[model samples]
Target chain A: MDEPLLRIVDVWKSYEDLQVLKGVSFELAERDVKVIFGPSGSGKSTLLRCINMLNPPDSGEIYLRGDNITAPNVDLNAIRTRIGMVFQHFNLFAHLKAIDNVSIGLRRVKGLEKQEARRKALEALNRVRLAEWADHYPAQLSGGQQQRVGIARALAMEPDVILFDEPTSALDPELIGEVLQAMLDIAKAGTTMVVVTHEMGFARAVASEMIFLDDGVVIERGTPEHFSVSPKSKRVKRFLNQLDVLYGSHEKLLKLSEEEEGK
Target chain B: MLFQTELEFIGMGIVNSIIIFPISIYIMRWYSKKKDMPHIQLWDTSLKTAYKVSLVWLMVNILIGILFNTFAKNITIYFLIQYYVYMIIDLFIGTIVVKSIYKKELGESFMFVFIIQVILFGIGLIIGFITVLLLGYIFPEVSDVFFFVLEFGLFFTLLITASSLLIGFAIGISLAIMRVYGGKELHWLSSGYEKLFRGIPLLVLIFIFAFGFPGLFWYLESLDRLLASVIMALGLRSGAYQSQIFRGAILSVNPGQMEAARSVGMNKIQAFRHVVLPQALRLAVPGWSNEYAVVIKDSSFASAIGTFEMTFIAYIWGLRSVELFTLSMGVVAVLYFLFTFPVTRLFGERQTKKLKKLGMGGG
Candidate 1:
């Protein structure tokens, strides 16, 4: 009700002839957990990237708190420091150890002293349960551990909100749970998050709202229960059904449906 | 020739095989390990490989034997017998190495070990010749010729090589960074410099620096004009080549590294300085070592302008007599080998291993 923590108003982006995000808008309040998912080439990842202006929208307004981030002459580095990003590839600095990867943003962008930055980085790593891996390089760490380090990197920045662009998509199936669990823990700790993911279990467990984006526009937006109970659009139903067949529906959705059959 | 009679030659052949077999096998083992040859059963495929390699060796040895016999008189019989003995021992050693240590399938192991044995023999023959040259057992007429070239030539050759490589590498990396990440104008400027320098031959460039620049600039006249000109020509030319090496190295680094740095809220310059450049430099080391060797060889070109490097010194002393000229040139060739070979092996191999450990440079 009181000013949403972040606001996106009709963001439109394209690459040459291809329109990736068209008039996509969203709002997130404090401590909210939002999940965006759709079929491949649905512009879910592009919309998330547009939040931090990693890929700036062609025409749109993105506001962080009350400041218009999309406006010209805004200090992008400063704005980026406040809007953290976790990439699908877990792009940890190849040359640096886990601690350095986590602390680089703190020291460079936040202007924290080395010791202070390192101390905070370790704390963030501790949250992801990877504090012991501080000395290891990304090449030495497993996929799950590397992604956790990536999350720690963003968490150490203490940003206004974190954007996760398919954080577990690049991971092996077995490794996906640990990264999702880290995200869940962050959500429980009252962090504001906008995640683009295919993990239905994670969506059902923590997403306050689930959005289905198609053809660069939000097709459906509702509570997770609302989608499983009754999705308004046939397109949304078909897409979610395909995802369920491929990745399996969440445990709660199965139980909810079973209860409905009994009734 | 070391043994006089048939009986003595037979005894010496046995003795030589005993001594050389272990050394040959040791080298083969090292080569196999370095090649990462997988252990497998031995095969007979190496028979053909061995025969092919041995045939080449025999032809080369016979040719040399003919030359020696014709010129030195009656050395042919001894040389031919020695070559046959060495060839038999080499095949014997190759079979043993392939069977025991190489662990590759019989055919492939034989092929590999046989080829390696030929290389070993070639190296051994070269070492024997060089030792004879240095000990003055052969070419006693110009025994001091090597010392003469090395004493004076080493300084100028090193000066030109060191100066050019340093200057070239510095400008090279700057140009590489500009070409890779700079704006359109900067890219054009860097690329244009590369094309201009790379297009001109090193000798012509040296001439321009030596003659043209001195007339126009005048400051070059204060220095040793030839030495400064040689360094400038070689260095600027090397910069163009080294720039390509570094640019390729930079391009080889994963693009994700740059994206990661930028996503951390570092500006483009900050990201490049901290993230992309360090990895790119490591990747460039092996390529740059080749550049070092190139500059070393090109230092010989400075002789065209009479800067008195090893090649020029070889030329001056070589004019004394026909035989002395041949011996002097041979010594200078050895000296150049000594300059380039060890550094390439030590720097290039070790850097590759270290980079591999860091999971960089595709090593």
Candidate 2:
């Protein structure tokens, strides 16, 4: 096997007395899509956040291309420049237009020139199919449009990996499809990604590997086929069954997955 | 039978009437302009009114001068008319110049006209001095401290206002930062500083810093008397109000903003500088403008410590010539309004525009 692009080992995290991620371990090959799914408070989001040191694990080791990012000697800023995270809330700068929001971090953090950063930001926005809305403020844009801008902002960095923390979770149902379609395009373009989402259909379609977590622990890990059809753990089976009922038809769920993959 | 007053009293009353009537009209015209009356209309009407009123007053003064001369002693209506005409002309020219400059462009032009008026008025003083030199050949005991105080008083007020704002902004921003992001002890200290200074009346704070703090800092035995005390009091008191303005602006920033900045690889300081503080400061403008107006007005308290500020000089002149009190106070009031009123209005208008842009204004 090729060397993993990212490696997490023995990661432990807590918020005060409440332990959120318990001794989790994971690895990702270059350009892999890894989807983590669980019910709320299952620490799936916490795990993705820890990878970029947004919530630094209490005791853990995180390595990016064999460099120990969790070690004190490593420059977290240099590490962060290569890793981008998209938030559930679409945290675009309210004062800035979409293009400016994308360009600012590139200019300030990566030290890109104004014209060069702006050009790159426009390219990223175009890639997300939001080129027309570049001049619009976050307040002016729809939720889906804002999320696309958030993705464009992250992509402008040309990060080695993108972390998505429930990206479409905050969107209206009709708007969620647009954001998810953007994510599907990103996955097809072979950007390494770690996404924490409850979108089971999205998980089954794009993810090269699926992790099912419960109670701050990874309860099941397998390919989409295994998790969807004959999940070995009772928790996995029960979760998929509940989703099957909510979504109405297993065939519809399969079609949704196929549509995302075809995209 | 109706005029029972003594000849000297009647002459003084005529002099007082000549000074008071024109000044009152000037003030009323100024107030009307400030209320945003059309500049052309304001100028045209006030000029006509001043011309009519001054004509009637000049005639009355001449009649009084002749009558008083015939009854009690010899009097010179010539010198009094010369003085009155020069002043009315100066006031007319100053008003027109300032109003025209104000109408041309808002900020720097108005300030330029105001400064030119001061210089031209100073030249008027030079004319007075030369006239005094000519008159001293006849009357050697004439005093001129009153004119000296009037000129210096305007300059001193501008100086105090500028210093208060500069020093206030500096201390205020620093204290605001400490209050927002400092460690536990520093935050408490900043909060305590704001609370203590803002709670007490500005005059009380000035008194304490001027009279009381010196005893505490007496070991530093080289402090200048008025300068040290006034600067200390004004800076500290204005800093307290400024900090609150800053803190409120900072709080008004959305929480998601900080999180977004942090997620973009900025540390706390970088996030604040790049993402947070810029927006926060924009929000702070209206509040800071109010604080600025307060600082300008409160700087009058410097007079209590004998700082030779505008109000203090006005007081000195008022005490010497009781009639000059109303005139001097009016001058000080005009100066204060001139300093703060436009800035307040500009900030208020800008704030309204910002709200409209944000789509947060009324639907």
- Leading candidate by DockQ: 1
> Per-prediction DockQ scores?
0.43, 0.29
Q: A1-263 in candidate 1: lDDT tens per residue?
A: 47789999999999999999889998999999999999889899889878888888999899899899999999998888888889998888887899999998888777899899999999999999999999998888999999999999999989889999999999899999999999999999999999999888888899999999999999999998998889999999988786775677477567767988999
lDDT, candidate 1, at A77? 86
CAPRI accuracy category, model 1: acceptable
Q: Write the per-residue lDDT of candidate 2 for residues A1-263, one digit (tens) a residue.
A: 45689999989999999999889998999989999998899998889878988778899899898888898787777788789889999878877889999998889888889899999999999989999999888888999999999999888889999999999989989999999889999899999999988787788779999999888888989888988778898888877777775666778677777988999
| Candidate 2: segments with Cα more than 4 A from true spot | A244-263, B1-158, B199-201, B204-229, B306-342, B352-363
Clash numbers, per candidate = 6, 0
Tens-digit lDDT track for model 2 on B1-363? 312223323333333334344454456557767887667464545444443444444444444444544574444545445444644554455445545643433243333333433343345455555754675555332223333333445444445665666787788888889988889998999899888887888777667876776664565433345555666677777888888888877877877788778777777788899888877787878777887788778778878777766688777766767666776676667666755786587676667578557533232
Task: Please state the interface RMSD for every predicted structure, separated by commas.
Answer: 1.3, 2.1
Worst 10 residues of 2 chain A by lDDT: A240-249
Task: State the lDDT of candidate 1 residue by residue for B1-363, as single tens digits.
Answer: 542333222222322233343355545546656777565123224433443344344333333433433465343465645656756564665455545644435554554655566566566555544754676775565556765665456556766887899899899999999999899999999999999998888889988988776764455554468888899899999999999999998898898788777777899888888888888888888888888888998899988888877899888898978887887888888877866775576568878887886677773
Local distance difference test scores for all models: 0.79, 0.73
Highest-scoring model, lDDT: 1
TM-score, structure 1 vs. true: 0.74
